[model samples]
Target: MKVLLTYTSMTGRNEKIANYLADYLKEKGADVDLEEIIDTDAFGLTDYDAVIVESYTYHDGEVPDEAQDFYEDLADVDLERTKFAVLGSSSKKHIHFGRAVDYFTMQLNSSNGEQVSDSVKIDQDPDEDDFKRVRDLGDRVLKSLK
Candidate 1:
């Protein structure tokens, strides 16, 4: 399956999670296109069998500035047949932990993408359990494509 994995990582944790998940999906035989969210085209998601988004929440629970264009663009895209999932690594210290993950998940659903897994939100750093959840998210997305 062709999967598009787009992410934004200011502190590297989300980038690491995105890479790990991309590798996990690749090992399972998926054709994965890993890109930075700013470099990705929201209108192009429909070209993939599955799409995954990873991000970091910013001040007051906003999508990072670098990814704002893509986030807003998502509202206009139609993903009726795209299977999707969202995950983020943010500080649990923040009251709105991983809110960007929530925003993306809701927007993708609103765009009509078939959600393949529940969104994942990891605090500051990922531990063993967090990695497992990321893998599980990847597994669900890949499975839904079959």
Candidate 2:
């Protein structure tokens, strides 16, 4: 399957998660294209069979500035044929932890993207348990293609 994994990270936590997911998906025999949200421009959802968007929430559950354009682009597109999942990282102390994932879920649903699994939210840095959840997430996405 053709998969695109994109993320925006300030402390690199999200980047690490994205990389792990990419590698795991590749190992599962997927053709994965990984990129940072800032480095991408005018991408279409139809280009890939599935997409995974990972992001860190900014103040009050807002999308980070670096990933705003990519978020907006996804919101603006028709994702009828795209299956996607969202991964969010945030501090558990925050009242809106994982709000970015919720936001992306709404946007993806609005744009007609098929949600392959429930969104994954990581509190702070990932640990062994978090890695297992991420791996399960990747497995779910890959399994959806069949």
Top candidate, metric TM-score: 1
Clashing pairs in 2: none
> In model 2, what lDDT does residue 112 have?
88
For all candidates in order, the CA lDDT equals 0.94, 0.88
Which residues of candidate 1, in runs, are more than 4 Å off?
none
Candidate 1 residue lDDT tens string, 1-146: 99999999998998999999999999999999999999999999999999999999999999999999999999999997689999999998999999999999999999998998999999888999999999999999989988
The sequence of per-residue lDDT tens digits that candidate 2 reaches over residues 1-146 is: 99989889999899899989999999999999999878765357678898888889999889889888877887678987589999978998999998888888888888888999889999999999999999999999999998
Quote the positional error of residue 11 for candidate 2 in Å.
0.2
TM-scores for every predicted model: 0.98, 0.95
Off by over 4 Å in 2: none
lDDT of 1: 0.94
